[model samples]
Target: MELNLPESRSRSIRCIVKLGGAAITCKNELEKIHDENLEIVACQLRQAMMEGSVPSKVIGMDWSKRPGSSEISCDVDDLGDQDSSEFSKFVVVHGAGSFGHFQASRSGVHKGGLEKPIVKAGFVATRISVTNLNLEIVRALAREGIPTISMSPFSCGWSTSKRDVASADLSTVAKTIDSGFVPVLHGDAVLDNILGCTILSGDVIIRHLADHLKPEYVVFLTDVLGVYDRPPSEPDAVLLKEIAVGEDGSWKVVNPVLKHTNKKVETSVAAHDTTGGMETKISEAAMIAKLGIDVYIVKAATTHSQRALNGELRDNVPVDWLGTIIKYSK
Candidate 1:
């Protein structure tokens, strides 16, 4: 796939965050949500996003830099000012977890067998399940006083060809940022030109948006502490604290030389997931890093994730922080 960058923006998007399905939901329980975890995440987001929740017409570049800034609308673009956002505007994407995974997996929806009656039924069921989850997420964020607009890929004009991104117009997403409203999108059942329909994962969505929007950084909030040397729970499993990606998208663990290539670097995928799981998440993170964007994968609701979300995870991270950082090789 080509790295097609979007038109120049005066002020680039601050950051893109992906909330893992397994991290926020009960994967073992069908359609069950982790309410307490969601509340914790919402409160964390509120402290970051809802602090200066007022709509401002930021007219000039240094408006926010000035103390006691007022609602200023500047017609001039910020020219992709790296510090312009201060994370005032951002995007959020989440996975299906136990929500739509069961129906989609049973119906074989991702394999593009929608011509069958059962497959079609599964497609409908999957969307209904995931969208219900999406609304719940939106309500949680809203309760924190964050203005959130829920967007489904199916309804947002996002389609796929051969299960790859074929048509995805994110103008509305950019417009949503311009309007100071956070856009919350989730994994969805998308129409595929080759197959009648297919599943679009949130990880893929994060990569697609990063390739186009060129955000300051990206964060993945997951269930596990971070990437491991092998499948998690293994006795000898070693956490990969940092990874560096080559220009061609190849990545290597920073300190310990990993003998296994990405092909052999194993990860566990949920049985009900139509889209790939942890493996896909890591793959997407590397691709984003190839674009020179820092990608952080940390456990949700942890102090590490809070710092990452609030733009506090800089080059000089806390010594005790435990997570995987994928960045472009120097």
Candidate 2:
């Protein structure tokens, strides 16, 4: 079906949050969700949506204005909206976490050819697992008095081609946010044009929605502080406070807690994650930054995350927010 929604690069969304599977679930364990984290996230989301400014253009490193030197022109794009109106509309997408990964891997659901009994059965099983978690999150948000509507990717007409998003009918999603209700989506088992069925990751879903909705900013909530110099579990890991993305899509750590020459970032994915974990988050976050949108990758259930989701990152000139801000270095 043709979505037939009014298309605008301008902001119709306040923010898009991706709840990482690892952060909300015990990834190494099968189908286990971290209940406390989910509740915290739901409450944090409730507070954020309660207050938000309208969408505005995100300013970045505009060398043309300075000519000789680079500078953050409003940098709040350094952090959003053309209308100057006051409203907060949100679309939330969450990862499968420990919920569906094991089932998907066992049934080879990511391969897409669902003709086999194993793949088909695995597809249904995977949905059941992820949706169970979805229901929990929805209930938590509901308990917080946030008007949340769960919209599954499969049920919402989202499909992929060769593991990339092919088509998604987000008309309902748009309508939900416009009507002041949050649309909660999760990483899902989806039908693929090339492969019979495959897993559509939450990271990919966030990018797709950002491209279409152009929210003022995007937030990625995880368990760890933010983007790390290496695996967060490692002894030598350091949190990178800021990242700058070039037009070419390459990224470098701008503000490392411990000064070092190596600007390259690294992250290790869990074995159960069919979708690439931390690495995928950085890559997609860079893409969003390239669109001149600021991205906040922060630890959930923290003062930093609370500040981030509430749109308080750009209050100071030096930008002293605790989290990684993926910025566009144009």
Candidate 3:
């Protein structure tokens, strides 16, 4: 039940990369995988592994020891000795976009409690759909020659009545990483102590793993490039290249001076999503950032998407990075 990783493994940089459901699946279509995008990300992961280098750059106060710069710097010194024979250990968690969202929404899975008898069918349907998608993802990663092991959160994680993660058995996840296999997990319908069942988001899974694994980086690959001053759909919207987390774990826009007329920032979530969309992702990343781990939110469809997941910042700077950098600030 213990991770019991070797001292060498403990010193290696550990990363958790999340592929958002929206990034991999067409939310409007039923169980459709974005094959082209998935292939891009998979190839990137394989390339990173083959090269045996950290892909993305780490930014913010936690990493730089200094702040206020337009871009954060990477601390290569902390990246432990690079071994050509082995790749950095990573844990991947993906969302259930078109696969589970439609069914979960219909089943009231996000309601945080038991559902009516008729709604039970929705719950069953949601699980089947999500599992099917998991298989597809695993197949794709395998095709790219990435050693992947699919793990179901339902089998290992539990949540409270309020739907917060109560406990999860991550020993297997840790073991898989130690064995050099990427553990693939997804959002799932799980048994809740107070509620008969509820939806457990992949974002929540990342948070829990971060607490346990203390990964050096947590990257979220989504449909958008990164957090924007306004929704990306807005013409005036500018990407918030970097965000700082307050001492109390609140989010602070690092570059709030962008010229955008919209005072209110809106986040886009797919119509079928039962989980809070961009809002929940940002909030969770901020909390993780407060723990001194740098979090990157980037678009998975970009050429740089896979690089971001590997912890590689495009220009070795946060501003130039393709995604939003969330880090802790004083």
Candidate 4:
């Protein structure tokens, strides 16, 4: 049978997608066996490949916490015998979990978790760790045929003068898009003028990417099944089927531990250590849609990614992508 390829106007309309970590990580509960959830995500991705419902060059990001800055090793030699497809034509970026968590926590460099000022020594330590992590990821991707490059949040030249992601020309990514290769990126530690020092999450990287690529859809395969008005872990929570990015472009902050009262208000909370979360994502989506792009946030563990990519088209949006919508007003 002939495979159904994704329909595209230009067949070259670049799609800068962001796949979340939790969606692809091995769950602790099932560590005894092959991680069923991670396998499921891979199966979905493989299905998408078989169906030809996505771009030929697919970039899969595994934004997990790395061991540590010193231990951070992206050496292809060390990755001996790994599947060629894992990095082929894919620009990959992953966070250093051990490095970031340890340094950030030690130096008190956190947005949601910290209340006190960061010590200058700790602050510099965290920044260096993040930068080193990016370099390791680049090396690994490059060895796997991705030819990846690391872009530091600092020294990248952003208008805000804040070193979140140095707002560089994403032409390399566009070039990758055109050549049917994947470009992977992740969040970096940043020098926030307002906050002094902060960690930027990979979700923030996705946002900045969307701004540049303007893909037909930006899919965020996160841990949860989309954001809930209330914690789905709780009994009374409701899945917010859709959300419209407001003119002001801020998301409503709903704590998983707290009950929500007003559905009408846009809310946001401080991201744990990084500057990315549901709120950050929604805000970024709003900014991207301002350029007429569409965004989809979905749960990766489920079959949603495959369904969303290959499922029937509806109202200019594909089904099963599952997440809140950030629409643009005509």
Winner by lDDT = 2
Where does candidate 3 stray beyond 4 Å?
A: 1-13, 52-85, 112-115, 259-264, 314-319
Clashing pairs in 3: 55-310, 55-311, 55-312, 56-310, 56-311, 56-312, 57-311, 57-313
lDDT of 1 by residue, 1-330 (tens): 323334555577778889899888988899988888787887676555533544243222222223466675443464455233344667889998999999898988898877899999999999999999998888777665566789888888888888888888687778777777789999999899889799999998989988888888898988887888778778877778888899888778884566665445665667777688777877889999999899999889888888888777666677788888888996
Give stretches of model 4 more than 4 Å off.
1-13, 24-43, 46-99, 108-160, 163-166, 191-197, 246-261, 264-272, 309-322
Superposing all C-alpha atoms, what RMSD in Å does each candidate have to the true structure? 8.7, 13.2, 11.6, 9.8
Q: What is the C-alpha lDDT of each candidate?
A: 0.80, 0.81, 0.77, 0.50
What are the per-residue Cα lDDT tens digits for candidate 4 across 141-230?
Answer: 343234345655444432122335534445545565445555556555555555555666666666666654555655566667677664
- The regions of model 2 sitting more than 4 angstroms off are 1-4, 7-11, 52-87, 257-264, 315-320
The weakest ten consecutive residues by lDDT in model 3 span 57-66
Ranking of all candidate structures by their TM-score, best first: 1, 2, 3, 4
Which candidate do you rate higher for TM-score, 1 or 4? 1
- How accurate locally is residue 11 in candidate 4, as Cα lDDT from 0 to 100? 44
TM-scores of all models? Answer: 0.84, 0.84, 0.83, 0.60
- Worst lDDT window (10 residues) for model 2? 54-63
Local error of candidate 3 at residue 240 (angstroms) = 0.5
Over the stretch 1-330, how does candidate 3's per-residue lDDT look in tens digits? 223333444445468889999999887888899999898888776766665544353211123223567775555465466332466787889999889888898878666455687457777888898989998888788666577888988866545456887667776677678887888999998877777788899999898889778988888989988888767888976887788899887776776565544445576767777888888898899989988898989898676566676567623664455678898888
Q: lDDT winner between 3 and 4, please give it.
A: 3
Q: Please give the ranking of all candidate structures by lDDT, highest first, separated by commas.
A: 2, 1, 3, 4
lDDT value for model 1: 0.80
